[model samples]
Each structure stands twice: as structure tokens, then as C-alpha cells.
Target chain A: MSIFVDGNTTIVLQGATGSEGSFWAQHMIEMGARVVAAVTPGKEGQKLHGVPVFHSVRRAHAQHAAKAAMLFVPPRFARDAVLEALDAGIPRVVTIADGIPLHDQIQIRAAARAEGAQVVGGNTSGVISPGKSMVGMFPYWIERVYRPGSIGVMTRSGSLTNEVTAWVVDAGFGVSTLVGVGGDLVPGSRFAEFLPAFETDPETQAVVIVGELGGTMEEEVAEAIRDGVFTKPVVAFLGGRTAPSGKRMGHAGAIATGSSGTVAGKVKELEGAGALVADRPCRVGELLARVVQ
Target chain B: MRLLEYQGKAVFKEAGIMVPAARVVRASENQALRDEACAAARELMSAAGIGRQAEQDPTGSSGGETAWFAPGVMVKAQVTSGGRGKAGLIVRAESPEDAGQAAVAIVEREPSVRVILLEQMVDSACELYLSISTDAGSARHLILASAVGGVEIETLAEQNPTAIQRVSVDPFMGLQPYQTRGLGYDLGFSGELVKRFAQVTSSLYQVFRANDTELAEINPLFVTQDGSLIAGDSKLIIDDNSLNRQPQFEVTREQYGTDTEYEAALEGIPYVQFDGDISLMCAGAGLTTTVYDLVQFEGGTVANYLEFGGPNYRKARRAMELCLKNRSSVILIVTFGTIARADVMAEGIVGAIAELKPDRPIVTCIRGTNEEAATETLADAGIEPLLDTEEAVRRAVAIAKGEQV
Candidate 1:
């Protein structure tokens, strides 16, 4: 009920034979997500950790009904891997690679949308449903706070998810679901797509959107929130003003490319949209706490 | 990620795309660079303006390159990332001195004195932007083109997305020239420069594919008065993730200190460049970024990126001490998002500041984490740890501006 992925998602790995792919696959499995197939092109018919392997996604689709895909393929094969799964009818695809051309990303995004499918990232840590399912490597051992509750969390920063989740938990709250939409330039889903999911979820009473500088995404979300599609009280934070000058604020999409991408600009927009914009990331949970109370 | 127009020309040239004979300004000390640039500019100026220049400039120079710039030229900024023109990172100058002055200004705006990309300007009838990258869900390399190109491409796409057309490219078969030409046809690219622009787009996409690039763009792609097409100004953003596959680009990245930032980002520490009075020491990116914002919000400037480095109290405290040694109005430590023993670290910092000749006020608001021990110790050591980032930054700024904290 939280978002695109649910408890019943049977996911496959496109680059599952590689170390990164295997490591995150183990995490996804540990998080109780169904890890049904692994595809590595030539390493077909091979199984690692008891998961079946296939040469192509078409074979994997025939073997196991993979509803979602998490990709760890390098940039070179990223394009092929993405479409192969989509063409195979895997409706949800999440990639963790960064730097494939933007044109490819645009085409992929358009293609994905055309099929009523959702793609998560090209440079991301995957998605998570606190205490239920997680993709990519977020230390679940240290995170004991996601005990299943009403707050929905969305972050562009992959590594920051752990810290943000810990905050949500320590403040006597729990997250219904947390989605880490990749931080690369051409990530699959922007906040616009994730907002409706949070809005429709009965369990999600509020949302904590963690943003960075560099893109107009925060502004876009602010406009949407202002449009009144979402009724839940939204608490947001943009994490780049203190960004050591010259450093990228947490994500590729966070780059302050044009005027619309600055933290001040984002904060003003979010605030103007009636969002209780925290000046810093630390203020996110506390601000939500007051609103929820 | 930005590449100079010349860098785009290099990719186009490498892909067997026809561009003007060009010379990039790679060496600042070498006078031959200027000579080569001047020669290339003249050759290109005459070539692209072969038939048109006879009517525009009877004295024989085009794009206002005479006197101010190398005669018959266009001056461009050869930066490593995109949106330079929009960022005011590039300028079209009238003369070499004007171009040099603009380059100097660009370098001045930047922290370093690196070379700027300046090219021979072309006279054109139309402008466009052509680009290529990975299409994730489609799982194909993609080519995108817009007849309406420039810094305003994003706006154009938003206002009229249909005007921008795309083509899915298969990896194994590579990008077909026919596919690119078809995209041109769809975008209504039918003119003398159609084949040439199509070729450039194909070559640009090829270069993008060949280099394992994240993004390669040819903006302001000019269709000149003559039957020639020129890459007017370009911007390329390569994927730092694919640097290993693209060594040449990796080296250029190193020259501009992108490699250091890239490595630091991988290590889980966010780095930002700053010019300020203080060097911050804090745990986590959220805290650091917050402290930075609060500082700026409160009228305090920061220096270079300095992290508390770790969650360990001792290492973090030591890091705090090192940052305090710099000339800042105050040494502010703040943590949010899993403070992880930050209170103990704050205690150590207070203890260290007490033992040293501290000129700055030590302000911090460390929340989260169960640090009863650190809190008691810091209080006993006579240091008051502020609980709010805003207050900490406020007190720190007042202290730095010569007010009593």
C-alpha cells in the first residue's frame, strides 16, 4: 500500500553475477524481498547462492515471474539491460549505475512511461519499505526504527537514507515506506511520480522529502504540492547550502545548474507551497513530529 | 559535467564527423598555442565563410575577430561542464584581447587559472542541439535532437516536448546513420546542412557511446550561410562513474580537481569548495551541510571542505581541533541524522579548546545518539553546548564579528 513495490514483489537482478550485484542481492533477500532470478548474459545456467541464472532477461522471464528488476550492470550494458527487462514485461526497473548518456536516459524514461512501468534509478541505492523490503546495501542491522508506521520518506541521497531513517526512528516514529530514487542525472522517477503514491497510501499520513541542490526537481515538487494533489502535511529539507563550495550537494540531480536549482530557491518554493521546509536535514523529523502531533 | 566546444569538436572529429580544422589552447606558456589558434581561426573563418564573407566583411574578418580577438574568430570558454553560457561561464568576445580578458575573468571566477576554449566563430542560418545517452527502461542508447537549441533547451522541451525528437539505438548494431538521419527528418532537418548535422549528431552519439559517457551535447549547432555546418558551442558532462573506461577524460578531470572530489564522494564524505573564515568539523553530510547553511544564513563564511571524518569521539575531536586552528570567527560543530557519539566528541572538543589558546568561540548543537558521558564531561569542563543549529550559528557569527558570545 506504500508505493510501487509491495511485499509481494518478486525481483530479479540483471547483473547478479558481479560482486556488487551479489552483495545487494543478498541484502534484498535478507530484507525479505523475493530474489527470483539473476541475469548475466554469458553466465546463463549458472546459479549463485541458489538463485537461477539466465543468459538474457527473456529466459529469466520464462523461468521465474520477475515483476521488478534491480540493475547493477555497468554503464556499457545498462541501456541493453534496461530495455531487455522492459521488453520482457517486467514493469518495475531500478538501476544503480550512473553516467550513461542523458539521451539514453530520456529514451529509457519515455519508453518506461509508455509501458505503464516505473524505473527507479541509474545511480541510486534502490527502494525500501521500512522493516520489510530493502534493495541495495543499507545496514538494516543498525536501523531498528522502521517498525512500520505512517511516515513516507523519499531521498535522492542513497547513503543518507540510513541516517535519515535512523532520525525518523529515534524521534519515536516509523516509516511506512522509504524510497531512494537514484541521484544520477538521469534517474528514473522524480518526486512528481512518487508523490501520488504517498498521497494515495492510507497508512502514509505525512511525507519527509530529503532533497539536494542542482536540479529543478525540488521546485517541481513544490509546485505539485502547491497544486494541492497531496493533502498530507509535507516536511522537506534541501541539503546543499552548507555544501562545501564546489562540492556536489549529495546528488547529480541536486546540482544547482540554473537559477531554479539553488537551495534558497528550493526552500522559498517549498515554503511558498505551504511545506514546512526545514533549514537543514536535521530539522526534517522534528518538524514532522510537531505536525503529526 | 561540462566540456568545451572544442572538446565536443574533438569528439566529433574523432568520430569522423566533419568540423573546421581546429587548434585547442592546451598550453598557456607556449606561444605556439596562440599561433596555432590564430592560424586555425583564419583557416576556419575563410572556409566556413568562403562564399558569405565576401558580402559581410569586405576587409575579410568575420564574427568581429579583428583587433580585439584573433582575427576572424569566436571566443568560447572551454569548461569541463554544461550550461556554461547560461551560467555566464562563457562569452563571445570581439578580439583576442577581449577573448583573453574574458578567459581571465572565467579563470578568475574559477579557483584556478586554467586554459579556456576559444574558437573561430561561424556564421550560421540556424542553431540546434543534438545529444545521445543511455535509455534505461528501453535498454537502448538514445539520440535526442531539438531544432530549438541553446541554454533554453530545457524550457523548450517543457513548453513544446514534441519539437524534440528521440531515437532508440541498439548497442550491438551500434547507432545507425539512417536512424540518426531519420531523427533529423522527424525533427524537420531538411536543408543543405541536414546531412552534415545528421553526421555530426551520429558522430556525437558515437563518441558518447565510445567513451561510455553519461551525456554529450552539441548546443548552438550552427548551419552556416554556406553549405557548411559547424558545432557552434558545446557542453559535455561525462560520467565520473565511467572514468576508468575513459582515461583521457579522466585525466582532464584530474587537471580540474574533479578526481579528488569524485574520490571523496565515493568515500561517503561530501565535499564543497568555500571561501570563508571558518573550517567546520562535524559528523555526517546532513550536519555539515546544515552547519554550512546556518553559517551562511547567519552571515558567517566557510573555508574549504573539512569533515569531522569519523564517528569515533577521539578522531572526531581531533578533527575538530585541526579545523579550529584555522582563522575562523568560531569553530562550530553540529550533527543531525544519527549523531553517533557526537556529544562525547563535543566534550572532547570543549576539553581541547579549553587547553588551547582559542581565539574563536566554540559553538555546537549535537543532537541524536546517547552521549550522556560526553554531555556531562563537556558541561563540567565549563563549555555550554547549544542545542539548536540556528542558535549555535547565531552565537558563532556574533562571536566572529567581534561580539561577546
Candidate 2:
């Protein structure tokens, strides 16, 4: 009943020979993700945790019929890898590299749109449907944080989501699917883009969004809710309420500029759109209780 | 990284864009370097045929027309930040000596300005704005053109939105010829001027792509009296992530917001210093900012925002040392690791404490993978880890305000 990835989804691992790719590939396998193939140029025939390796995504797709790809490629090569996956007709892709050039990201997003597929992130931790499959770098074994339940979570930050979701679990709730949309100026997908899936998933009773300043993705979420595109109880916690303008706080995309992309602006918009906005991370659990009930 | 005007002009020149004849004079305390710079300025003015006695009319008039004088040279401070005109960092001088004096005055007034650019002023008939910038919302590169230039584009957009014409370019299909021509016509250009405008914009687009520039701007793309186009000012901001591919532009520590920020960049850690008493070290950017908001909500200000996790998790010790160097009375470490192991972060914090024992109160809320080990490590180091972020933030804020635990 969860969205995006599940136990039946066969995944291909890009950059599987790299240290990060190999490590996360094993973790994904342990969490029930079907890592059927790996792709690393010039490393064909090698096996990463018993997954068959190929030189290209197309070759991997042909041999294993992988439905999704998890790319651990570096920022410089992120565009080509994602395009390669899209070219191979892979319906879903997840990129884990940060610092991908803005121009490259634009191209990747265009390609994904043209292909009618979904791409997760260039700086994301990845996605996880707890107890079904894990496709990202999430430590899903943490039962206190990631027990399978009815709450669907989408986030822009990796570590912050862990903390907020812990509060969600503490409040007697568990996640159906958690999607990390990535914290970049141009994410492969936006926050509102995933709302329809959560809305249709019967297992998902409500959605929790962990958003930040910078980018109009949060505003887009508000638009979706206002337009009745997503008719579910939604609780959001937006960071960087006091961040000074023109100062990039940690994330490249997390900054306030001019009058737009401010926390207050996003909060007002989301609240006006009939969604409850939490003042703090711990308050997310309480807000969800109010809205979901 | 935002390049100085002179640097951006150099990039524009490399792209074959027409720019005014210019010379650079760097401010130096050394007398010899100052003398050399002054001499270079004089040579530049002389080369431009200014102050040549033979060219001046004896009557100082052309029949019944007004008296004609040599065009003044523009003495501009080479600074990265904008608003130089309002700050009086940009001035016009009639002679090389005046230009040198202007440069000296600018350097003396704005200590941050180290270099000055001396350029022959163009006989401009019209000033227009043209730029190629990345539009994050649309996930496309945008070409913004306006007939109203020499002013802030944002203000202009607010005042008269139609004054600016925006064209979004697909990354796969870059600045097409027809798109440029369409923009030129939309900006009120006709005949050969539109072609020339397209040429200049095409060259600017080349510069934008070649340098991996997030923004390549000409605030006043000057139309000379003879109808020739020239870039009156250049602003190029290279993407920081693509700096490795752009070897021509070297980033210095001074380019960063602060010395500590530069140091943090070297360690792959994101740090932003603030004016408060509570220092924060978190695992991610979003968390660090949220914690900052929580602290401010609880009536406390953060001294700095530093996040070390993901690939930077191993640098926790160094990040902690950075927090220690700040003027905060207490340090708050709030981290809930997913991909970043909590034990690794705890070990780094413990190591940093062991190496440099400080007298400030440190509150921690560490969780995630191998939490028991992280908890045990902090306990062995005489630090009890709090599990709740709000409780930790409140405690840190109270401790910073000198309240009881």
C-alpha cells in the first residue's frame, strides 16, 4: 500500500563498485530491496553483494529488467547517470550526490519529465517504504523511528527528517512511505509532486512534510492543497524561520532571498491552504494528531 | 562565487564580447607598487588618446555648437558586492591623476576594496540590461532583457513588470538564435542592431556555459553614439560546485563571508556565524536551522550554525573545535543520524573534548544508528546525552542566559 518502492520493485545500483554505492547496496538488500543488477563502467561481470554488474544501465536493464535505479555517482556525473537511467526506460531513479551543478539538474529534470518518470534527488538521502523496501541511505533498522504505519512522510533534509519522524513515532504513529526530495536549488521532483501518490495510498492516513526555506517547493505544496489536488490531512514543519537574508545556511538551497522563500511566507501560505504548520520539529507529532484525528 | 567586476570583464572579453578599453590598478601599501599603478593608469589614459594636446580644438568649440571636451574615464572599485555607485565607489575622472586620486579615495574609504578598474567611458546613447541566469523554480536557464537598465532589475520588475522580458531556455537546447532575435526585437531593437544584440547575447551565453556561471549579467549593455554595442558592466557568478572544472577562477578565503566560513569550507562543513551566545552543531542544514529557530523561539540567539553529517560526519571533531572558537557561553549538539552514524559523531565529539577541555556548558541530543554506543561514549566522557531536541535547546538557552539547570 506504500508509494514509490516496495518489496516487488527490482532496483539497479549505479556506481555499484564505489565505496558508498557498495555500502548502501548491501544495506538496501538487507532491508528487502531487490538489488537485481549493478552498473559501473569497465566493471562488468563483477558482482556487488550477489547482484549482477554491467557496464551500462541499458545493459543492466536488459539483463535484469530493473524497474528503478539508485545512483551513487558523484555530482559531476549525476546528470549523465540519471539520463542514462531514464534512457533505459527505468520508471524511477534516485540520485544521492550533493553539489550537482544547477544546469545539470535542469537537464535531468527535463529528461525525467520527458520520459514521464520520477527522479528523487541530487542531494537526497533517498526514499524508504518501511517493512516493504528501502531504496535510499536511510537506517531503516531503527524501529523507534521507522516502524511501518499509516503516516506518509516527505522531506528536504535527511537528518532533520530522522529527528522529526522520531517524534512522529513517539506520538504513536509510524510511516507508510518516506520520500527525501533533496535539498537543492532544483530537485528532480518537488514536494507537491508526491502528494497524489500519498493521497491514493489507502495505508496513508496523513502526510508529514519536513520543509525548509529556499525554493518554491513548499509553496507548490500549498497550491496543491488549496486546489484540492491533495485531499488529506497534512502537517508540515518548516526550518530557517530566523535565517538572515542572502546567507546560505548549510544547504545550497536553504537561504532566504528578497521577500520570497521566507519561513514566515511559507507558513502563512501553507496555513491559508488548510494545512497545519508546526512551529517546531517536536510539535509536528502534536500537529499530526490534531489534523489526522 | 561572485566574481569582481574586473574578473567578470575578463571572462566577457575571453568570450569575444565587446568591452571598453580598461586597465586595472591594485591598491597597495607599498610605495613602489603605488607608483607603478599610477604609471599604468597614466599609460592607459594616454593610450586612449586622452589629454593629447594636438586633438584639442584651440577655440574649444565646433562652429556654433557647444564646447567639446574629452570623455572622462570611469574609475570603479573592483568589489564583489553591488551598490558601488550609491556607495561612491564609482567615480568619473578627467585625467589620469584624477583617476589615481579617485582610486586612492575609494580604497581608503572602503577597506575591503583592494583593486580598481580604470576604463575609457563609452559615448552611450542608450543603456540596456541583459543577463542569463538560472531559474530554480522552472528548472531552466532564463534570459532576461530590459530596455531600462543602469538600475536594479528587481526594482524595475516591481515598478513596471513589462519593462523586463524573460525567456526561459531549455538546457538541452541552449540560447537559440531565434530566441535571441526575438528577445532583441522585444527589447525595441530593429535592423542590424538586433543582430548585434543577438551576437552579444550569444557570446554572453557562451561565457555563462563555459564558466559554469549561475549568473552572467551586463547591467548596462551600452549602445554607443555610433550604434555599436559594448558591455558597460559585467557580473558573473560561477557556481561554487563547478569551481573544480573552472580552473581559471581561483577562490580565496577573503571571498567567503568570514574567515571562519572559509575555514569550514575547507573541511567540507557548512558554518555560518551569528551574533549570539549559544553555539549550535547539528547533523544537517535543515536541522541546524530548525534548532536555530527553536533557540530563538525560546528567547536565545545562536552564535553560529554548523552542520556536519553525511560525508562530513567524520569531521565532527574539527567542527566541534570550530564551535569552541566562537564566543558562545554554551554549545548545543543536536543530531539524529540516519545515513550519518551516531557513534561516529559521538566519537568525534568525545575526541574534540578530550583534546580541548573548555569551561562552557555542552548539551547534546544524539540518536540514530548504534545509539547505545554513542550514549555510552558520551556517558564515559561525563556528558549525559538528552534524547529530546526541544529539551536540549531549552537547557542550552537557559544555560546561556545564566539560569539554573
Candidate 3:
């Protein structure tokens, strides 16, 4: 019933011999995600949290039948790793590097489209399907935040996801899945791209979006809602409301260029499209309650 | 990083694109340097066959210097931001001495402008716009051209959308010849003019790809009276992420923001200072901005926005030290760490506080990924962290207002 990953989904860990990669690979395994194989160029046959290791994604995919690839590669190599996963025919890929070049992201998106697959991030924490399984950096053991339920969550921010999703759980609801699309100028996939899956999932009765003021992704989500591509009730909390124009508010993509990509612009568009827009993160849970009801 | 006019022209020249003959006059208090700049301007004018009559021989039959000093030279202030022509930062000078005077006046008017570009003004039959930029919507490099040039492309798009013709270039295949030819024809060029236009467009695309440029723009691509196209102005912005590979672009502190911002940039932390009373630091960009909003929503203005998370999660102490330098009444740190461990961030925060204790009140809402250990670390340091972000922001705002927490 989860959107992207579940307990049955066999995952391959790229860059699995690295420190962050190894740590998260163990964490994913601990959370019941089937980590079948690990990929590191030189360190083949090494085991990561009892998972078999291979040098190439194709070799790992051939042996383990991995459906997904989780990348812990650095920014410079992120594009190649994602492309390798896609080339190996892995249906889902998630990259956790935050500093991938914009051009690299463009190539990654094109490759993902051509392969008919989904790549989650270059700056993301990863995706999590609560209770059933998870393939990201989320601490799923925290019941106060990540209890299994029917609401779907898609975000462009990492830390904000934890805070906002905690509010969702606090509102007497839980999440079916949470996807971090990453906060970059060009994400491998966008918020609207995941909406169709959320809409069709019987467990996902409502969706919560943690968007920011930059790029047209939030506006695209609004367009999707207006076009009836997604029919489920949605609640969104947009960040950077008080950010000044022309100043890059931390994220490379999180800048208001000219008049577009402003918080007011996103708010108006989302609200006009019949999605409940929460001004505060705390209000997300309350709005979700109202929308789902 | 946005390159100065002279720098961009140098890059264009490297790419084999045609540009107007130019000389740079750097503003300085040194008298000798000032005289040299004036001399450089005079030399440029003489080279362009336009100079003072006094500098020429009394007899008209001297050298190859032309008698006509008609179109004159252009004195442009070499600032990164645009609207120089409308802001009176660009001036036309009929003589070399006039060009020097114009440069002096421009530098005087805008004291921050340290460089002036003096170029031979081209006589144009018409102007066209051309650029290669990364388009976020299509996730590709876009080639945009228009016959109607240089009145701000955004304004032109709103008023006359069809005037701007766009073609998305595939990242792998690059900009094709047929695409540029089609663009040239669409802009109403024909015969040899179309060929030349296509060449310039293709060369500009090469410049874009070679420079790791986010935007390579030629506003007012002047079609000279003699049917030659020359780039009147160059706007090249190199991708910040690609700076490691682009060693040619030396990012100076002056090219960007204030001292604090530059310092943060060096440490790979994204920080933007504001004119407010609260110094806000968070774990992620989205969270940092949301904290800014909440602080403002609670009627408190933020003095800065600094995020030290993701790859920068371990640099919490460094981030805290930077935030401590801000001239703010209160400091607010909020993070719901996921990939960034809360305990590690707390240790860094505690370490920073112990090393450089400030008098300002500090409020935090550090949670997620070893929250208990993080809370314990903060408590051991005599800093109690709040659980809710809104409550922490309210407390910080109240503390800034000199009210009870």
C-alpha cells in the first residue's frame, strides 16, 4: 500500500563502503528494508550489514534482483551513480548528495525519463514508508514522528520534513510514505511527479507537501491538482515566506528571482487550486485534518 | 559568480565570439594610475581612429588615423548588477578626454564601482538578443533569441511573448547547428547574415558549455551598419557549484555579500545576513527560511539566515561561531535533524558556547535522530532546548523584545 518502497522491495546500496553509506545501510536494514547488495568500485565482495557487495550495479542487480538503488555517493559522482542504477534497470533510485552540479542534475533527469524510472534526490534524506520499511536517513524507530498510517508526505527539505511530519503525527494521524524530493534547482523528480502514486494508493487518503519558495515545483503541484491528475485532499506548508528577494536563502534553488518563485505566488496558486495551504508548520496537521475530513 | 563586463568579454573573446574593442580603466586614488587610465583611453580612441586634433599632426596627410570622430566611445561602469544604461552608468563620449571624464563621473557617481570599461561604440543597423541559460522548468539549457533586443527580456516576454524564440538544448548533444540556423531565420535574418548569426549563436553556446556558465547572455547583439554582428555587452554567470573545476574564476569577497557571508561561503555554509535583531541558524535551507518566517510572523525580524546541515552538519560549531558574530540581540537555533544527527549538532553547539560565550540569550529546538542524547548534551551545557519550533521562536522574539521568556 506504500508508494515507492515497502518491506518486499529489495534495495541495493551504492557507495555502501563509505562512512555515511555504511551507517545508513545498517539503519535501513534495521528498519526492515531488504538491503540485498552493496556497490563500491574497488571493494567488491565486502559485506555491509550482512548484505552482499558488488562492484557494479548491473552485477548486483543480476544476482540480487534489487528493485531499488540507494546512493550515498558524493556530489561529484552522484550523477554517474544514478545513471548506473538506471542503466541497470533499477526502477527506483535515491541519491543523498546535496551539492550535485545543476548540469549533472539535468542529465540525471533526462536519463531517468529515458529509462522510465524515478530518481529521488541529489540532496535528499531519502524516502520512507513507515512501519513497513524505509530506505532513507529517517529515524523510523521514533513512533512519535513516523507511525504507519494513511497520509502521504512529499517534501523538498530534510530537517523541515521531520518537524512538519511530526506535526502530522501529532494531529492523531500517521504517514503511509514520505518522499524527500531534495532542495535543489533541478530535482531528479518533483513534488507533482509523485502525486499520481499517492492518489492511487488506497492507504494514502491525504497528502502533505513541505514546499519552499523557489522553483516552479510547488506551482506544478498546484497545476496537477487543478488538472485532476491527483484527486486526493492535500495540505501544504511552504517555507521562505519572509525571505527577501534576490537573496539566496540557504538552498541554491531557494531564491526569489524577479517576481516569480515568491512565497506569496506559491501560496496563491496552491490555495486557488483548492489545496489547503498552511502558513505555519504547526498548522499543517490541523489543515490535514480538515482536508481529509 | 557574475563576471564583470571586461571579464565576460575576455571569456567571449576566448570563445571566438566578436566583441567591441575595449580598454578597462580601474578607479584608483593613485595619481599615476589615474593618468595611465586616461592614457589608455586615449590610446583606445586613437586605435579606433578617433582622437583629439591636437594629438594628430598639423598637416592632414600624416598617418592612417581617420579624420572622422563620429560615433565616439562608450564608458560603462563595470558593476555586476544590470540596468547600467537606464541608471546613467553608461555614457557616450565623443573624444578620448571626454571618455576619461565620463569614466571619472561614473566612478564618482557610484563610488562602489571600482572598474570602468571603455569600448569603441558600434554603429548598428538593428539590435538582437541572444543567450544560453539553464531553464529550470524544462531542466535543460535553453537558447533564447529575439530580433527586438535589450529592453529587459522579462519585460519583453510579458509584452510580446512571440518576439522571444526559444529552443531547449539537449545536455548530451548540445546546441545543434540547425537549431541556431532556425533561430537566426526566425529572428528575420537571411543569406550571409543568417550564417554569421548562427556562428555567433553557436559560439555563445560553446562559451556557455566551456565556462560551466549558468547564463551566457549578449544583450543588444549589435548588427553593425556593415552587416557584422558584435556582442555589445556580455553577461556571464559561472555556476557556483562548478567553481572547483573553474579555477579561472577567482571568487573575491567583494564580488558577493558582506564579510560574514563571504566567511560562511568559505566554510561551505550558506548564510545571508539581514537587517534585523535575531540571528537565526538552522539545519537545512527550508528550515532556516521557515524559522525566519516564524520569527517575522511572531513580529521579530531576523538578522541573518545560516544553515549548517546535510554535508555541513558536522560544522555546527563553526556555524554557531559565525552566527555569534552577527549584531543581533538574540540567537535562535532550530533543527529537526534527520541525515544530520541531533546529538552531533548539540555537541558542536555546546563546544562553541563553551569556547566563545556570548551575552545574548540562545533558544533552540534541536530534535530528531538521537534526540535524547542531544537534549542531554544541551542540558549538561546548561542550555535547555525547546521541543516545539514555534515556542522556541516565540521565546526568542520575546527575549529580543526584552519581555519575560
Model 2 chain B poorest ten-residue lDDT run: B60-69
Q: Kindly report which residue stretches of model 1 are placed more than 4 angstroms away from their true locations once superposed.
A: A4-116, A141-147, A159-172, A219-230, A241-250, A262-276, A286-293, B16-18, B24-111, B116-191, B212-215, B253-272, B280-291, B305-405
CAPRI class of candidate 3:
medium
Q: DockQ of each candidate's interface versus the true one?
A: 0.22, 0.71, 0.72
- What tens-digit string does per-residue lDDT give for candidate 2 at A1-293? 89999999999999968787788889899889988999999989888898789999999889899888999999999999999999999999999898898778888988888889999998888999998898788888889889999999999998889888988998999999999999887889989989999989999999999999987888999999999999999899999998888788877788776777898999999999999998888888888888775
DockQ, Cα level, model 1: 0.22
C-alpha RMSD values across all candidates: 7.5, 4.6, 4.1
TM-scores across all candidates? Answer: 0.68, 0.91, 0.93
Candidate 1 — what's its lDDT?
Answer: 0.65
How do these models rank on TM-score, best leading?
A: 3, 2, 1
Q: Give the per-residue lDDT of model 1 (tens digit) for B375-396.
A: 5666777778565556777777
lDDT for each candidate structure: 0.65, 0.84, 0.84
TM-score of 1: 0.68
Interface RMSD of 3: 1.4
The residue-by-residue lDDT of candidate 2 on B127-243, one tens digit each, is 999999877656788999999989877778778889999988888888899999999999888998898888888999998888888889999988765456778899898877788
